[model samples]
Target: MTVRVDQFPEVQGVVSEPPVQARNLSVGEVLGQVTELVQAKKYDEVQALLQNAMGQHPNNGDLINANGYVLTAMKRQSDALRWYRDALEFSPMGSGIWNNLGTAFKHLKFYNVAIACHQRAIALSNNEAFLHHNLGLCYAEVGQHGEAIMAFDRALALQSDFHLARWDRARSYLHLGNYRKGWADYEVRLVSGQIPARSVSGRQWTGTPYAGSRLLVLAEQGFGDTLWALRYLPRVKGLGGELIVECQPALCSLVASLGVADRVVAKGEPLPEADYYCSFCSLPGLFTPDLSLLPAQPYLSKPAEREAKFEPYLRKGAGCLKVGIVWSGSVTFERNAERAISLERLLQSVDFPGVQLYSLQKGSPEQELQGVELRRPIIDLAPELKDFADTAAVVANLDLVIMTDSAVAHLAGGLGVPVWILLGHSAHWLWLLDRADSPWYPSARLFRPRIEGDWDHVLDNLAIELMKLATVKVPLSSVG
Candidate 1:
C-alpha cells in the first residue's frame, strides 16, 4: 500500500540479476517499433517483442516500461504492476513510467495512490497534458469537481485541442451548475469521437430559423436521455417547417403521441429526406445553454388505449398510495454501478404506513424479486410493462415514483408525475450539484448519498419525506 516511490530507495541499488548482454536494436529503437505495434492495437505482438528484448537487456528501464505499458493496454493491471515496479527500480526518474504506473494503479481502483503517482509524474514532466487529464479523472471519481476542473484547465492550457479533456471538463462544469460553460465544451463530443454523436450527413442545425427546411432531430445516448430531452421538442416545433424525429423503436410510440414532430420514425427505418439534422441531446446548446428554453412537462400524454390496457392492474391498489419503483438502468452503461441501487435497499424507502409499492423495473433486474420476501407486498409490473409507452401508462396511475436515477425517473418526471430520484454522490450531471430539485424536471426531487454507495442513508432520508406524503393523499391531477 506504500505508493510513494521514495519508500523503495533500495530500488535504486540494484536491478535485474546478472544479465549483462546486448541486442542488435537499442532500447530506444525497440521502443519505437513497440510504440507502432501498440498504436496498431497489436498488444500481444508488443509483449512478445518486449519479452525478446528484455532477455538481452533484462535490467533496461525502457524494456521493463514497454512490457508494463502493453500489459496495461491489455487490461492486465495486476500483471502490469509487477513490470511497473521493475521499471521503477531501473528508471525511478522516468516520468513516462510514472504515468504508466499511475494508470495501472488507477485500473486497480487505488485512486489515492494513482493520484499521488500522477502528481509525481507531473512534477517530473509538467508539460504532459494527458498526465493532468488522468489526474483530473481521479479527482472527479471522489466528487472533487472543483479540483477536477482545475486539473482539466491545466490539461487544456497545455493542449488546447485535447477534446477528451474538454469533454470531461464540460461534464465537471455541468455537474457544478455552470451550464453555460458546460454546454459550450460539451459540443466537443462531436469532434472528440469518443461517444458517438448521432446525426445525419446533412446540414447541422445551429438554432437559425428552420422555417423553410426539414430538420431531423435524432435521439442519442440512453433511454433516460431521450426521455429527458423529448420535452424540448415542442420548443423545436415552433422553429421548423417539418421537424422529423428519429428515435429508438421503444420510444417511437411515445414520441408520436407528443405531436411535436411532423413525423416520428424509429431509428434504422426508411430514410426521411431532411435539409438539416440535429441531436436531441444537443438541443440545449443550440437554443440556450441554461434552463430557460425548456418547455412545460407532460408534453407527452398517455395513449388512451394503452392506459385502458393497464387500468385493471393499476386499480389493484385503489385505496393505497400507489408508488412505482425502478432500481436500476441498462447494465451496459459504464456508470450503472454508481447510479443503480439494489432493489433490497430501494424497498426501504417505500415501507411507510399506507403506501403500496409497485415494481416498474424491467429487464433482468426484475428477476431479483422472484423469490424475495418483503415487509410489504410489492406488485410486480415488470412482466406487464412492454415499453416506454406501457410504462408511461402505469406511471400515470402511480401516486409517486421513487427509484434510483434511471429512465423511469425521466418518464415519470416528463409526465409531471412526482418522482423522488436517488442519486449517487457524483454520477448523472443533469441533476446538477448539491441541490434537492432539478430545473429540467420540476416534479423531480433529488437525493444523494452521504457517502459513496451508501443507499441506506439516502433511502432513510427519503422515507421521512415519503412518510409526510403518506399522511396526505396525492391529488389525482398532479400525476396524469
Candidate 2:
C-alpha cells in the first residue's frame, strides 16, 4: 500500500492511524495485513511492508512505531530502539511510543532507562495498566520487590483481569517469603499461559480423604522444583490412596527410588488409570501453607549398587573433610547468570585446609575447569556422573556438600546430607529472604550475599565456616 505523506497531520498522543494512502486504503488496513504476516511468521514480508510504509510516510508515527514492533519481534532490540526514537520525534507525547521504547530497553537490560521510560508513559497516561505492569517488571529486575508489588497492585486495581500482572505479583510475594498469598496467587499461572492446564477429567486432589483410590500427580516446572515437591508425595500416599507420579525423564529413577509413589511414569508417556490428578507444585499449597508444617527430612535414598560403585572414590586423606561442589546449573536457566559462579572465582576465594573438594558440576559449565590454575585439588567426578542417582551416591559419601543454588542442593537436602548453599542477594523463592536456614531442607544451611553480586563476601564467610568444620572429627560411617 502507498501513502500520500502530505495528506496526513503529525498526530499526537497514541498515533491512532497512519498517513492517508494514494491507493485508497486506510493505513489501518495496511497495518492489519502486516500484522497478519507477522503472526504467520513471515518476518521477511513484514519487514519489507514496514520499510515500504516508512519510506512513503517519512513523518508518520504509526508506521515508524510498527517498524519498531517488527524489529523487536525479530530480536533486533538495538535497531528497534532507533525506530522507537524516530517515532517519538514525530509524536513526542505518544504514550504508546514511550511504552514500546521502555519494553525495547528492558530487552537490552538497560533497566534504569526502561523504568524512566515507563514512568514517563505513566505520567502521560496514568490509567494504562500495561505501563504499570512494565514498570513493575523493571523494579523487580532491580530487586525492589516492594516497589514492584505496589506497581503490580496499581495495575491490578485498574484492570482486575490482568492475569500477567497478578502472576508477577505472586512471584514478588513469594520472593519476599509471603507464601500464604503467593501460593494462592500462583494459581493464576494457568490463566497467564505460564503453565498449560492439563486435560484431566477427574477432580483435582485437594488434600481430601480418598481411601483406596488412585492419584496421578503431574510434574511441572524445573528439576529442582520437582525434587522439592516430592516431600509432599508420601503425605498424599498416607491419605489412603495409591500414588502415580508423572515426572521428567531424568527424575523418574530418582522419584521411583523414594518409594512415595506406587508407580512412577515419565511425562508424555501413556498413563495408567487414576481417580484424580494434581500438579506437583500445588501439593505444597494444600499440605504446607505454613512453612513450619513442612516435613523436611531425608526422604530419598541411593540404590545400593550405585553407592557401592562410588565407594572407591569416597576415600579421603586422614582427618580430612570430603565436600562435593557444584558451581553451576543448567545454562539455559534464566537466572543462571546471577546464580552461577565461575570455577576460577570459587577456587581463588575459598581455602579449605584438610578438605577434599569433589566437582559435581556438569554440562557446559564443566568446561570452565580446563586450563585454569587451581589453588587446591578438586577431583573431577563430573565425567562419570550419569544422572541424579549417580550424583546422590557421591553426596552420600561426602562429609559436606557446598554448592550454588541448583538441583544438586535439592538432591543433597533430600538425602539428609549436610549441605551449605550459596545464594545471591535476591535468591530463588524457595530460599526465601534473609535466612541462614530453610524450612524445606532441615539439613541444609544457606549463605547469602549481603550485597547484590558480591560473591567474594559470601565465599569468605563460607571459608570461615569450612575452617570450623575442618577442626572437627567425624566418623566416615556417619557422614551420610
Candidate 3:
C-alpha cells in the first residue's frame, strides 16, 4: 500500500494525507490527536478517534493508553482497566499509564490492586507529587491511615506548597484521633485555595491584640461541625475581644444565646464592623491544648419562649423516665443512609417500661412520628427554631437524648447533656477508632456499627442500654 504525502508550497513542508481511498493515519498520530481531543474535553471525538485507531493498531501501547483515558473520562472504569493493563505490557516505563490504571482500580473499589499499581508508578517516577497524593487517597480509602499519612508526607516533601497534601494529611490525622496534629493541619482551609461558596470575601483578619477589636467569624460546612467548633468562642471573648458571628439564619437566634459573641447575624446579611475575621470551624485549631480543662458544658443563650412552651410537654411522671429519641439521621449526608436506622426498627426494638418517649427531632423526621407512642406527638419546631439555642432548650428539658450522629447530637453534647451517638461503620473522622467517648465532646458516647452498612446491631445494643436505664432507680438530685 503506497502512502501519499502532500507538499505545502508556501510552508515547504510535507504532511501526511489520506492516500486516494486510504483508511486512516498511523496509530501514533491517531493517539496523539485523541490525547489532544481528550484534554480539550471533546469526549465524543476522542472516543471515535480511539475506536478507529484501535481497529488498525489494537496492540499499540499509546493507542491503548489513549483509549483507557477516554474510557475513564466516560466512567467506563472496568473497560478502562483492560486497556490500561494492555498498555502497561507495551510501555512499562510510563508512570502516567500506571497512575491511570490505579485511579480506575480505585474507583472500582479494588484497593489492594490500586495500591500496587500506584506504588509501581511512584517507583517509576518518584518526583511526581500527584502520584504520591493519589496513592495517599487510595490508602485513606482502604483504611490504611499510616500509609496514607506517609504518602501525603512524601507528597509534601516533594512540594512543600501543596495545600491538598496538607489537607489530606490533616484529615488522616483527624480520622486517627490525632487532634493535636489534625487541628493544626486543618488551618490550611483558611488561606488561599478552593474557597467555599460564600460571599464573605474582602473581609480582613488582623490577628493583632484583641483589645477593643471586634472579630467577625463566619460559619462554614455542616450544622454539627459549626456547633462543635464554636466551643472556643469563650477563649476568644476572654481576650478582651468582641465577636460578630455570622451563621446560617436558622442558627443566629440560637447561637446568640451562647453569650460568647456580642452579635450573631445570619450569613449574607449586613456585617458589623470588625478589626479581624476567621471561620467558626477554625476555633479548635487556634485554641491550643488543655482541652480536658476546658469546659464542655453548653454555653448557648436560653430562649425565653422556647423554654416556656416546650417545658410542659416534657413533664416527667413520678415513675416514668423521659427519653428523647432520634433514630433516623439526615439523608443529605453521604454516610447517613448507611448509619441511620429506620424508625420502624427503633420502635420495634425499644423496650423501656414506664419510659416516656418524646420527639425532639425537628425537620424531616416529623412525618415519621405518625402512630408512634410519642408523649407530645412529634411537633414541627423548624419554624420556631431560631438557632441551636432553641434546640438546646428542648434538649435541656429531656433526661437523655439517643440520636444518630447529626446536628442534634453535637448540640446535646455541647450542652453537657448525656448523648448516645449511633455511628456508621465507616463513621466521621471525629469519632476515631474503637472508643466510646469523644475528646471533643465529653458528654457524647459513640456506638459504631460492627459491620459495614449494618444498623440493626447498633439499634439492638441501644435498646439494651435503654432498658437498663429504665430499670435503674436514682435519686432526684442525681438525675441531672
Candidate 4:
C-alpha cells in the first residue's frame, strides 16, 4: 500500500547566507537565519531560533518549511508532512515548500502521490534535477521502467555528473534485462575510487599481476551470490593468471575442489601471497562480454560417496514422495526477515497426504516436526554437515527440494538438482515478472508472488502444486 505526502523538487539552490545578520533585520530575515542553520545541518539550535523568529511573525511559510525539514531529518516523517502542508496552506506558490512535501511522501512509500507532487513542483520550477530523480524512483517502484529511464535522463541532462541518477538508471535498466546499460552503469563500483575503508593493509592487492603471480579472489557478499558468481573464476584463471581464492570458512574446501583456482583459504585465516585481487562479483565484466555469454556451467560438488551417505538418511516410510524443505536464509541480510517464511506457515501450506518432509535448512536450532513415521526428532542436519558438499549429498537423495532464495537454492541448482524456488513479491531482477523458469538456473522453477509484496497467496498456490506432485502416479522403478 502506498502512502500519500508532498513531493520535493530538485532545485538549483541559492547559496545559504550566514545565520547572524549584521543589518537591521525584519522577522522574515531572522527566519532565514534559522533556515541557514537547517541547511548547514545545525539542527539543535534550529528550534530555539525558529521559536524566537515565530514570536515576531507567527505564521511564516519559509519557517514552516524549514521546521518540516528538521522533523524529516529526525525521521518524524508523518509529522514533517503536516508541517509541509501548513507551509503550503500559507503560501501555495512556494515551489520549495511543495518540493519538501513531495520528498516526505516519497519517504513514506506513497509512490503515486509522490509522483504528482514532484510533477507539481516541476511545474512551479522547471529546471530541478532532484525532482526528476525523485519522480523516476517512484516510477521505477511501480514498474514504469520506460518513464523512469526518461526521468533519469532529464536529471542527467540538467546535471551531467549526477552519480545517484546514474546508479538508479543502471538498476532500472538491469531490472528490464538491458544488460549492456546495466553492466556499464555497474562499472562505477570499481571506478568510483572508493572501496570500503576496511583495514586492507596486509590483505588488499591491486590488479597488477606479473609472471607467476598468484591472484586472490575474495568472496565479499552473501552465500548465494558468492556461490553463483564463483562460476566465472575459471575464466579469470584462463587469462594467464595464477589464483588463490578466499571464501567463507564453511565454503573453503567445497570451493577448492572446483578446479578453477590453485588454493582456497577460509575467512580470517589469511595470506597465501597473491599479487592481485578482485571481488567475486567483479569477475563478470572481465570474463563475459555480455549477459548472453554467461557460461551457465555447473561448477559444484558431487561426492563419490553421495549415494552411500544419503541412503542411511532416508528410510522406507509410507509416504509416496520424500520432499526436502528450506524455509529461511541468512537473518543478517537486509530483506531476510521479509523473505523468510515461518516454519509453521510452510508446513501448513504443503499437503502431506503421501509425502515425508525433511528439513535441509542451515543455521542454528534446525526444524521441528510432529506427526510423521520414522521420526527420530527433526534432525538439525546443519551443524553436523560441512559446507555445500554435505548439503549436496542430502539434496541428491531427496525427490525434490522446495526452498526460498538462499545459498541452498544456489547449491541445488549448481548440482543440477531440480527445485521449486519460492520467491517474494518484487523480487531481485533475476526472477523478473510472472515466469516459471530462469535463464540463470535451467534446473529450477520459479514460484513468484501473484501481487506485489504478497506471500500468503503465492505460498497457497505452491501448496496446491506440491500436493499434485506428491500424488502423481509413477512406476516403482522410476522412484529410484
Candidate 5:
C-alpha cells in the first residue's frame, strides 16, 4: 500500500538502470507509478506493469509486495498470501512487506496470526502509522477494544490526519460503552469520506427545539441501524417539532406504526421542506445517551390486525411455545459473516421439546434449508414475509425470537418480546462489552461466544438455556 517501495533496505540485487521500454525509469520509479495504477483499480494494467517490473528487478521486495497488494485488491487473498510470503523471503526485514502479509492474513480470518505479523511489522518500522492501524483492526476484530484503542492512539500519534484510524478508534470506544468520546469520534466518518458527501438544503439540527418548525430525520446506514435508532424519535418528537422520518420503502408501514413522526415517508416519495434536518445515526451523539437511562421498550406496537390476518396459518398448532429464528442479516454488511452463524449450528441447540421453530431467515441463506433434514419440522415463515410489517405481525405470535445480530433482533426487542441475541464474540457497539442483558432492550438476553470466533460455546450454552425454558418456563398464554 505504501509508495515508498525501495527506500527501505535498499531493495538489493536490482539494476540501477531501467529497461528501454520504461524510458530510463529506475526500479523504484516504475514501482511508484505502479502504486498509482493500483489505486485507480486498473487491475489488468497493474498486472502488466508488475510483470514487467518483476522481470527487470526479479528479486525486488517492493515488486513482490506490490503483487501481493494488487492480488488482495482483486479479491484474491489466497493468491496474495503466496506473493506476500515470496516477498517476505527476499525482504525478511521489510516492515511494509510484513504489514501486507499481515493484511492478507487478516482477510483470511486469522486474527491472532495477523496481530503477530502486524506487531512484527511495527517492531521493524515503528514510525509507520498504517502498521499500527492494521494492528488495531485485528485487535478490534477479536473484541479487545481497549488494546485496539491504544493501537489506534499510536496510529493517530504517528499521523494526526489519519482518518481511517480515527473512524476505527471511534468503533472501539463505542464498543467499550464510552459514549462521551465515541460519539464525538464517530463524526470523523463524515470527514473521512466513508459516506457519500451530503449537500443539505437547510440548517442541520443539533437536538434543538424546533417548536413551530418541521424537522426531518433521515434514516442512514443499514436497516438494522435505523431500527435500533428508532427509539430516539420519541425524544426528538418531544422537542415540539412536526417530525418527519424518511426510510426505505420496506419499512414504511412498520415505521408509521410508531406514530411519533407527523409523516413517515418512503425514500423517493414526495418530500416536504423541513426547517432543519438530522441523520438518525447522529441522534445518539447529540443526546450522548446514557446506557442506564434507556427509554421504555415496546417503542413499536405489534399490529394486532396483522396478527389476526395471519391467524389461520398457525391455527393447527395451538399448544406449543412458538419460537422464531433469523440466521442472517444484510449480506452487504462488511461484518455479516462475523455476526451470522450457520443455520445448521443453531439447529443443534434449538431442537428442544415443546418448542415449535419457524424459519424467519430471508435472502440467499434460505437456500441452506433445501437439503437440510429436520428431526423436528420447522415452518418457513420467510416466504410469507413481504416487509418489516409482516415480520412484526408474525413476531406477535411468537413467545420467543432467537436470532443473530439482525434487524429482527431490533424489531422483536423494540416490541417488548422476549428475545435472545446470539452474538459473535466481537459483536457491535450497541451490545457493549461483557453484558448478559442489553440496556437498550430490557427483554433481550445476549449470548456470546466464550472464545473468539468459535460458536461451539455459544451453542452449548444456548442448548442448556433452551432446556431450562422447555422444562421450567411457562409457555406464554398468547403463544400457547
Candidate 6:
C-alpha cells in the first residue's frame, strides 16, 4: 500500500525572527511565530493566532498561507484549500503556498489537483527537493509507480539525504515487484523515523551466524504485518540461535503456538536476556531478498482444544458450504476506508447457493450490518471472538473465508485455510500486482477491482467464483 506523505509532520528548521519594529510586527515575523506554534504542536493556538493576525492584515499572503497550514494540520483539508486559494489570490507566484496547497489536496485524495499544484510549485522553484517528493507521493497514490519512482529519483538527486523520499520510493519499487531494490531501500524506514529503532542492549542482527546465541525478534508495525512476518521465524531459528519474540498482547498466544520462537513476550513486558535482536519484518530482507525462498506452508494452526470450543458454530445443513466473511479491518488503520467495504454492499452483490456466511468482521465497521437486509442469514461470531486465536479457532471450522484486506485474511492464509481476498486496484505491496496467486499464501486467491474504487466489479467477479466454489464437495474431515 502507498503510505500517505501528508501523514508525516513537516520538518521545520530553526529560523531567527527579524527584529520587531516600533509598531506591529511584519507578516513574516507573525508567520514565524505561527511556525513555532506549529512545530510545538499547539495547533489550536496556531489557528487562533492566525485568525487574529489574518484579521489585522487581511491582504497578507504569508498570513493567509500560514492559516491554511494550520487548517491542514488540524485535518480540515477542505477549509485549508479555501485559505490556500485566498493566499494564491494575494501572491500567485509564491512556490511555498502552492506546495502547501498540494499537500492539503493530497490529504483529501484529490490526486490530480495535488499533482497540478505540485507541478505549479516546481514551475516556480524547480530545484526544491520537497516539491518533487510531494509530486512523487501523488503519483504513487494514483498507481503511477514509474512516474513516482522517477519523481523520487529527482528528489534524491537534489537532496541525497531525503530519507522520506527514499522510503516512499521503496514502497513503489516493492509495489512493482522489484524486491531487491525495495527491501534494500526499506532500511530507510528506520532512518526516515517511520519505524523507530528498538533500544535493546544487543547489536542488531545482520544475517550473520548466531550459533548457540540467543536472538530476540522484535515485532514491528501492525498485527497483520507481524503475522505475515512470523513465517520467517523458523528461518531465524535455523540461523542457529534460540529465538524470543516480542509482540503485541493480542498476538502473544497466537505467535507462541507457532513453535519457532523459544519464548514469546508481549510488548511492554520485561524482556528475556538475548545476545542479538532484529525487527520481525527485517528478516525477509535478510533471508529472502529474492522473494523466491518463501515457505508457502501453514505455519500457524488452531489448537485442537481451541478448535473444539468453536465446533458448535460450524453446524450447517447437509452438503452446505460454511464460509467466514470479514468486510472490514480496524478503523484506525490509515487505509481502512479503502480496504473495507460495507457489509450491505457485499451482501447485495453476492449470492452463494447452499452456503452459510458467518460474519468475521470486528470493530466499528461491524455496525454496517445493523438493520441491513440479507438474502441469506449471516451468523455474527465477532462478539464470541476474544482474540486472534479465537478468530483462528472459529476459522478452523469454516470451509472457506472471503475477506477484504485485514488481519483475518493473513490469519486464514497462515493457517492454510482456503481464503479469497478482495482487493482494490492498488492493493498491498505484499500481494504484488497483476497476479491472482500469492507466494506468501499458497491457498489464498486474489480478487481485485477492475477499476479503482469499483467494488461492484470486484463483487460481481467474486459472485461467479463463489458459485464455482460452492459446486465443489468439501470432505467432512476438512470441516470441524
RMSD after CA superposition, every candidate: 7.2, 6.6, 8.7, 6.5, 5.3, 5.3
- Model 2: lowest-lDDT 10 consecutive positions: 4-13
lDDT of 6 by residue, 139-225 (tens): 988889899999999999999998988998999998888888899889888767788756786888998989989999987889999
Once fitted onto the true fold, the runs of candidate 6 whose alpha carbons sit more than 4 angstroms away are 1-23, 39-45, 369-376, 471-480
lDDT of candidate 3 vs native? Answer: 0.71
Scored by CA lDDT, what does every candidate get? 0.78, 0.79, 0.71, 0.70, 0.81, 0.80
Greater lDDT among 1 and 5 belongs to 5
What is the Cα-based TM-score of model 6?
0.89
Model 5, 1-480: lDDT tens digits are 343323221111122323235544566776666655655678898688788778888998778887877787776989988998999888999887777778788888898998998899889984778778889999998888899999999989998988888999999999988988998888887777776665555688988888999898886777788888898889999989688999888898988887788999897777778889888888888875557666777788876667876676565446767889888888888789888888888888998777778888999988887877875678887878898999899887788999999989989998889999999977888898889998888889999887767788887888888887774455598574
Off by over 4 Å in 4: 1-58, 62-80, 91-100, 191-211, 269-273, 289-291, 303-313, 316-320, 362-379, 472-480
In candidate 3, position 29 carries an lDDT of 62
- Residues forming the 10-long window of minimal summed lDDT in candidate 4: 1-10
Clash number for each model: 0, 0, 5, 9, 0, 0
Q: Per-residue alpha-carbon lDDT of model 3 for 1-480, expressed as tens digits?
A: 111111101010112333222248776466445544644678887677778768877777767776776777667889988988898898888777787788889878788999998888878874677678889988887678999999999988988887878888988998886778887777787663534745444345533457777788888878887887777778777777677888888777777776778888888788775677888777766664334554546654446667986755655433566667776666776556666776667766554566776666666765776656543344334555555667777787777788887888888887777888888766778777778888777778888777665777787888888888885566799876
Residues 408-456 of candidate 1 have per-residue lDDT tens digits of: 8888988889999888876688887778998888888988887666777
- Model 1 alpha-carbon drift over 4 Å, by segment: 1-58, 74-83, 107-110, 195-201, 468-480
lDDT per residue for candidate 2 within 96-183, as digits (tens), equals 7788788888777788999999888889874767778888988887778899999999999998988888988988988787788888
Colliding residue pairs in candidate 2: none
Question: Where does candidate 2 stray beyond 4 Å?
Answer: 1-49, 74-79, 108-113, 316-318, 351-353, 373-377, 450-452, 463-480
Assess candidate 1 and give its lDDT.
0.78
Residue 32 accuracy (lDDT) in model 2:
58
- Model 1's TM-score against the true structure: 0.84
lDDT of 4 at 340: 80
lDDT of 4 by residue, 1-480 (tens): 011121213321222446675444565555556546656667777766666666666677766776787678666889989988997887797777777777788777687787888788778875677778877977886778889999999999998777678877877887787877776676565544423433332344433443466677876767787888777776677666678788888787668767777888887886665566677766665655456777765666566454565565576433557777898887777678667887767777764666767788766415343333342234435654667767777776667788888888888887777888888765676665567887777788898876556788878888888888776566899896
